[model samples]
Target: MNHQGWGAPPDDKGATPFAYPEQPVGGFPGAAPGVPFGSEPGMPQPWNVTDSFAFAWNRIKADPGTIIGTMLLGYFISNLPSTIARFIPSDEPSDETSLIVTIVLALLGGLFSTFMMGGMTLFTLNVARGSFYRLNDIFQGGPFFLSILGANLLIGLGVMFGTMLLIVPGIIIALGLCLTTLIIVDRRCGAIEALQQSWRLMNGHKLNVFLWWLMAAVVSLVGILACCIGTIVTAPLLQIAFAFVYLKISGQTTADSVGA
Candidate 1:
């Protein structure tokens, strides 16, 4: 497979027809021919959740090692801050010092988790598009760091404000902006643009996306009920499913059309 640089998508001047501007570094996949942007002939009129989930399942089953391993590694590294904070030597530290350290660690953990989410999005997008992916693709989120971080902040504030107005608004905002990260990573757009695009994308499809989220929540709850070990499986499954949903909703060339 032909591989491009791992950082960011190539600039528009250098991008091939198959790639996005700034190469929206989701994963390091070689450019393959595909429908041009804005031309998703196979785009679903009303995407099927079952189909998305099935595509995710098939992809996972096809190569559990790369898919699961990359996700696991990203999760592990992202949580390292909290893991280390738990082991901090509390004996020698004053209460205030300990509290400060805990706050710092908590902040770091959130940032790491957000950063890893972007990386994972990249990897998952590769899978959704039937592009070659590697375990290291999870570390190529640096190019998307600012976009992801900004979007997160904006989404968080929007959700928080909406919650203050009423509980329903908060839920709506959360669902609407859920695809912000994927938009930013996939389109190389800034935070505001991605958030706007995501909001617009869900204009008439909120119910469908909500149902998908509900299904994911149930699966995750079941995984938790199954002694937490099941999360190791459910987590990656849902992640891949989400990528498929994003690709279909955004009218991009999905895994289903790779060789067609």
Candidate 2:
């Protein structure tokens, strides 16, 4: 699509493509691409929770109205599964039908949720990069919808099975695999490779990933507490924080830069 300046009229060419910055050899900023995270000496910390929040807060303030609105849109789309479940036909006095319907709807919701989440994520990343995007640009992730659905399912099952063995392993697996969705989006990799790359790429940094996840959860809780109105703000903040982290880990940001 033809890129335009802010406030310019829309063109038929849709969302402006923002190419991911190239790293030297490794995918991260200072390290060789394909190397494990944090392997290169003097490389920037790939998982700085502090910088993530700092960047998120600043980006949100820069475009409070648009960011919050996009986040709300994502949040609404992600909840459609529950809405569908509510409409499923139930056999009188039999809860089995309802249970089955719930699972089916949840699965479908989850599939759609990935696409919607990816759209919002692309939106946030564009914002972080200081590029222009329409409010509707979030839907641009539609192309990778099925890939994410499969990858998400595999990761979920893997994590679920791991968790069944013991809670610790499950959390570790979850954190390690958490970046799979982003990988699929940015790298244009398939479901299996994305999952593998995420697990391996995060090697030696699972604890930090857990920490970031914990922080994100806390922020989400705080947002929910704010009259259930703060989520639109905090949710996107968390996603942008992750986006910034992704850039940092991928070496798009300098050691001295937060990549905001």
**Top candidate (lDDT):** 1
Alpha-carbon local distance difference test for all models: 0.75, 0.66
* Alpha-carbon deviation at 260 in model 2, angstroms: 7.4
Q: How accurate is candidate 1 locally (lDDT)?
A: 0.75
How high is the lDDT of residue 11 in model 1? Answer: 50
lDDT of 2: 0.66
User: Model 2, residue 193: displacement in angstroms?
Assistant: 1.6
For residues 69-96, what per-residue lDDT tens digits would candidate 2 score against the true structure?
Answer: 8778777878888887888777675688
For model 2, the stretches where C-alpha displacement exceeds 4 angstroms are 1-47, 87-91, 95-107, 254-260
Q: Which candidate is the best by TM-score?
A: 1
Backbone clash count for every predicted candidate, in the order shown: 2, 9
Question: Model 1: clashing residue pairs?
Answer: 9-22, 9-23
**RMSD of candidate 1 to true structure, Å:** 5.8
